[model samples]
Target: MKKAFLALMAIACCHFLHAQPTRPNQPATDPANTQAPYLKFPTIPPFHLLKLDSATYLTKDDIKKNRKTIIMYFSPDCEHCKHEIESFLSNFNKFKDIEIVMATYQPFSEMKEFNEHYRIFEHPNIKIGRDEKFFLPPYYNIHNLPYLALYDKKGNLITTFEGTQKVDTLMNAFKEKKK
Candidate 1:
């Protein structure tokens, strides 16, 4: 009986000693704690991207202005991206007042070919470029192609959409932001 009692006491003491209190200054030791420390919003982050010309670098300051901006992340070989660009071209009149900046992490030659295929440069409001360093994918946590982030005239993020969104849906997001 004494041996059994001593064994139980040892087990209880071992458990108590192994369980440590979490310190206020230290991070959680739990391996299952995977939640982000903070929430991510649609605000534009500072980034340096190369234009299709491969000579000019467009920065965050260069794109900011007193106008709404639509920044799209796409891939040259993505069919969904092609569809989105086609939608924009077909509905160019509706987006005339908005600034459209399309960026891709693909090579300059591929971006040039894609731009030529769509003639995206003809539109004064549109700008297509390459993100050589691939900064946007991780920053935005992109998981799919044709990601769109719409910012208001004051450079505040209005909303973000992933995948192929209808033109009306895109426009309505901006309209709602205005309110």
Candidate 2:
């Protein structure tokens, strides 16, 4: 009887071991279950952000299919962000072919002020918007201000840069995506 009990206990232990949950730090083995926080290069994730108008929303589908996309995350209060925006504005002609989406988590009033100050909305290629719920920073694992994510014409991610970067560097990144 004791032998039978021991055998049952061993079987239970084996079953428990096999049924253990996956490690907390390890990603799931199932392809469907494993979704990275940030979209990898050549992969595009669906996103929805709010426009400064407080009425319209910009989704992945809103992106132009033929134009490469540059998504810039900025804070109105950050000096580096201001510098980056100024650089982009100064070199606006170089990026006329690309679609620029400048998003920020700052209040609508602040965003509007920043947009007016930089005349960002005056450009046909650039769209200044607000992300009120703060969805992007965490989704992209952004650790610094003036983060930039460049995507190909097909909407696939090309590269991501955190902190201030030169306009030429950004242009080159987009150019590299074509190759």
Give the range of the ten consecutive residues with the poorest summed lDDT in model 2. Answer: 36-45
Q: 51-146 in candidate 2: lDDT tens per residue?
A: 767799887677777788888899999999999988988888888898888889888889889988988778888887787778888788788989
Tell me the alpha-carbon RMSD of every candidate: 4.3, 4.8
Model 1, runs deviating above 4 Å: 1-42
Model 1 score (lDDT): 0.84
Q: Tell me how far the alpha carbon of residue 29 in candidate 2 is from the true structure, in angstroms, after superposition.
A: 13
How does each model score on TM-score?
Answer: 0.79, 0.78
Judge candidate 1 at residue 160 and give its lDDT: 75
Question: What 10-residue stretch in candidate 1 is worst by lDDT?
Answer: 31-40
lDDT of 2: 0.83
